[model samples]
Every structure is written in structure tokens, then in C-alpha cells.
Target: MMHHLLFCILLFPLSQLVCAREEAFAIVIPSSRLQCYFVPVESANHSKLIFDYQVIYGGISESEENFGLAASESYSSLTVAAETLRERLIRLRKQLDASEHFQSSRRVYETRDRMLMESKLSRVNFWSFINLVAMITVAGLQIYMVKSLFEDHSRVGQLLRRTF
Candidate 1:
């Protein structure tokens, strides 16, 4: 299978894919200068309008011949890189399909829900324990307040009555 894949990759014309001459990119707007360019509506569609700023910086030339040459060079390099990436992905996929890790991945995924629920349950139990403690503490405070209020013989109750 590996030999067959290797043979196909070598024989395939993956490098010969037709790519565009120029790549589209976002224009850089300078904060200092703003200008509007008006081209006749007829020429507005993909007009050879290279900005003066691009020319000043020795950027892409407006010559169609040079553009074609650059495009061909870039396309060849890009296709080679793409083919390498595809080959790597194919190899990795094959490795993964044959490995024990892929076989157990489904089981791992299935257990994730149980693990998450257990985590949530633990959090709920903790909060319940905290609430129980808070309730007990509030009950104790309420008992103390009641005792202080109604027990006439108690010093705390006498103090409270005098303060009130």
C-alpha cells in the first residue's frame, strides 16, 4: 500500500494545477494620507493600477510579462509545498488508521461525557456541602438571637433589652 501510494504521488500531475497570475491581498492604508482614485468605469474592472507607494518601495511591477514569470515561479513552489503537505497527511492518516490509538479513540471519546458529568457532580456535591454548612451556621445564629431576645433572666437578653 505504501509503495503504491508513493508511485501514485510521483506519477500524478499535482504540480501542474493552474493557478492565477496575481494573488489578491489587502491594501495597506497609511494614516497620514488619504486619496481617491477615479478610473473610467470601463477600466475599473481589474485595471493595472499599481499604487505609487508600491512603486516607491520597489514592489510588484505593473508589467504583465514580469507578473506572469513571477506567478509561474510562485505557483511551482507553492504546488511543490502543497504536494509535500498532502503526502505527509496521507502518511499520518495511514499510521493513525493502523495504530492502537485510533482503535481506542472512540472509547476515549465515549468516556469523556462520563468524566465531564462526574466533574459536574463533584462540583454539585461540594456546593451542597457548603450550603449545608451555611444553613447550620445561620440556624445557630438564629437560635442565639432568639435566646438573647426572649430569655429575660439571661445577661445577654438583659443587655439587648436595655440597648433596644
Candidate 2:
């Protein structure tokens, strides 16, 4: 019985249930009045025309009135419905809070992972740049030494030719 009641509460359209308890009336104006308000109608035979008007007040239908009365009579059921709705709302709020917490923790973990990747990339780039600079310095020193040795050999050949 409790399960059925809970299922009914979850499935029922609560807005319609609340609306059922309230009474509403529609005020209708005559079409002649509405037409006259927009445009005046001229009749050529005004002397032969006769108008009869009666004031009719609208009231709630008998069925609707009975339904409202029945709803009021079952006030205990309404109270139970209200309590069930409140409990459902509280449960939904707690579920929402838990989901939000889980999402925030996931975001934190993603941010940490991104930071670690960025640091690793930066360290790799730094080592590659240092290696390139060292290679260029070694190549420059080798070139200078080779050029100096060639100049010294040429000078020695010139001195030997002058002595002979």
C-alpha cells in the first residue's frame, strides 16, 4: 500500500490536483456589445427594430462544485499529499548536492592532470634547447681549430722556400 501511494504521488500531476480545489468563473460579454465597441452599426429601419436584453450571471457547474467539496472533505489526504511532496523535494535536493560534489572533484582531478602534463612538456623543451646549444658550440670550436692549423702549415712552407 505504501509503495502504491508513493508511486501515485510520483506519477500524479500535482498542478492539476491543486487546481482542482480552486473555483474559477469566466465573464462573457455579448457579441453585440463587442461589435458596437469596435464599430457602430447603423440601421435604416430603426423604428421597426426592437431589442430585448436580460442580465444572466454565470455560476460554477454542479459537477465542479461537487468535486471541490469532495476535495475539501478529504483534507487528510491533501495533508498526506503535501507531506509526501515535501519529502520527495528534500530527497531530490540531496541527490543534486551529491552530483554537484562529484562533478567538482572530477574537475579538480582533470586540472591536476593538465598541470602535470604541462610541466613535463616544459622540462622536455628545456633539455632539447640545452642540447642544441651545446652541439652548435662544439661545431664552432672544431671549425676554428681546423682554420688555424691550415694557416700555420702555409707559413712553414713559405719559410722553407725562402731558406733554399
Tens-digit per-residue lDDT, 1-164, candidate 1: 56434433333322121113244333443333333434343544555544222212322223422434577789999999999999999999989777867668877987998899999999999999999999999999889978778877888788878888
How would you encode candidate 2's per-residue C-alpha lDDT over 19-136 as one tens digit per residue? 1224332233432232221223365533232222223433233354444457555998889999999999999999999999999999999999999999999999999999999999
Clashing pairs in 1: none
RMSD of each: 19.3, 16.1
lDDT of 2: 0.58
Q: Each prediction's Cα lDDT score? A: 0.61, 0.58
The candidate that wins on lDDT is: 1
On the 0 to 100 scale, the lDDT of residue 71 in model 1 is 70
